[model samples]
Target: MPVTWRDLLDIFLVALLLYTLYRLMVGTRALNLVRGVLVYLLVWFIASLLGLSTLSWLLGNAATLGAFALIVVFQPELRAFLERLGRGQRFSSGPLALEELLLGLSRLSEKRRGALIALERRTPLGEYAVSGEILDARLSARLLETLFYPGTPLHDGGAILRGERLFAAGCVFPISESQIGLGTRHRAALGLSEVSDALVIVVSEETGAIRVAEGGRLSPPLSLEALRERLKGVARA
Candidate 1:
C-alpha cells in the first residue's frame, strides 16, 4: 500500500525514538558493531526496495546471521540497557538523599579528614567488593563518619551506595597506574567512573575541599552545600 501523510508521521516518530535509543547506546564499545549492522540492514533495505532480488536475499541471510552474533557480542551493552529501564530517564538516578551526607562531609571537611563516597549507578559493584570488607549498613551520617574516622577499621577503602542503601563498605577501589600525582581518593574516583557510571564524591584531607567525579570527569572544588546540590542534580537528571 502507498504511504500517506499519517503513515509518514508514524514512521518519523518511530525513527526518532529509535534514534534516541541508538544515541543512548552509542557510548559503549558495542556501538561500532551496531552501526555496522545498521549499515548492512540499510543496504539490504535499499536493495529490496529497488527489486535486486539476489543481493537482497544475500543481505537478508547476512542480517539473520549477524543478529545471532549481535546477541552474543552485545550482551554487556544489552544487560546495561536492560538494567537502566528501571531508572526511566537516561543517566539520571532520581533524587538523591543528601542531607545526611552533606552534614557528614561538612564535619569531615572541618576536621580535614579525607573520605571517598562512591554512589552506584547502573553497573553492579559486587566484583569490586572482593578487594575489601563488605558492610551492608543503612545509609546515615553517623555510619559514614564512623567508617571514615581516623584509624577506623574501614577508613582506607571507598564506600559504595546503592540507592539509599549502603551497599558495601571498606571497598578498595582499583587505582589507576597513571604517572600523574593523583592521590588515593582521586584515583579511586576515576577508577569507579571507569568501571561504572557511579558518581564519586571526594573530600580532600589536605585541602578540605569537596569534589564530585562522574563520567570520568571531576567537577571543580565545591563547598559542602554546593556538593550536595550538585549531587542532587546529578541524581535528578
Candidate 2:
C-alpha cells in the first residue's frame, strides 16, 4: 500500500498514547510492572525470531495470562488516572496562604513536635484523607500548630492540605519502606510523595528539623525560608 498522511497520523497517535501512559505510570508503583512487561515482550520477540519453539510457546502462553493479571493489579492507578482525566487539573499560580503554612510549620518545628503534612498538587490525596478525621476547616498557622499539638488526639496522625483549606487532620499516610533508620514521620512523608505528585512536609519531634519530601526523595533539613520557597514553587508549578 502506498504511504499516506493517514498512516503517519495513526502512528503518531499511538506513540502519543504510549508516551502519555508512561508519564502517568511514572510516579506510581505500576512503573516497575510496566518495565517488567516490556522486558518479557522483548524476550518473547527474541525467542520467536531465534526459532526457540518451546520457549516462545511458554512465554506466549504466560503473556496471555499476564495481560489479564495486570488489569487486576493496576486497578488503583487506573482508577486514579481516569479520575484525574475526568477532572482535568492544571497547576495554578493563584494566591496561597503560604505564610500561614510556614508560620504553622515553623512553630511545630520549634516545639519539637513531629508533624507530617501532605499538600495536594495535581494528584488527589482524597484516599489518604479518608483514613482520618475530616476537618474542612480554615487554614491558619494556629490550626496547623494545634493539629500536631502533643496533647491533641490527632497529633499522632498526619494532616492534609487541600488548596487554601485544612482539608483533613489525623490522616494516616502510607509509610515508606525504601529508606532505613528514618523516624516514623519522615517515612510517612516519603511514602506519600513516592506514590503521587504531592509535596510532603515533615517536622522531627526529636530535632525540630523541617524537611520536604517529593518525587520519592527526602530533602535535608531546610530553613524556614527554604521551606517557604518550596511551597511557593509548588503553587507556581
What is the per-residue lDDT of model 2 for residues 22-137, given as tens digits with 9 covering 90 to 100? Answer: 77667666677778888998999999999999999999999899888888966655666665455533323235467788888888888898999888877778889999999988
TM-score of each: 0.63, 0.86
Q: Which stretches of model 2 miss by more than 4 angstroms? A: 1-4, 68-74, 88-96
Span of ten consecutive residues with least summed lDDT in model 2? 87-96
lDDT of 1 by residue, 7-63 (tens): 999999999988877655554444566778778878989999999999999988877
The stretch of ten residues in a row with the least summed lDDT in candidate 1 is: 88-97
Query: Positional deviation of 181 in candidate 2, in angstroms?
Result: 3.4
Each model's lDDT:
0.73, 0.82
- After best superposition, candidate 2 residue 106: deviation in angstroms? 0.9
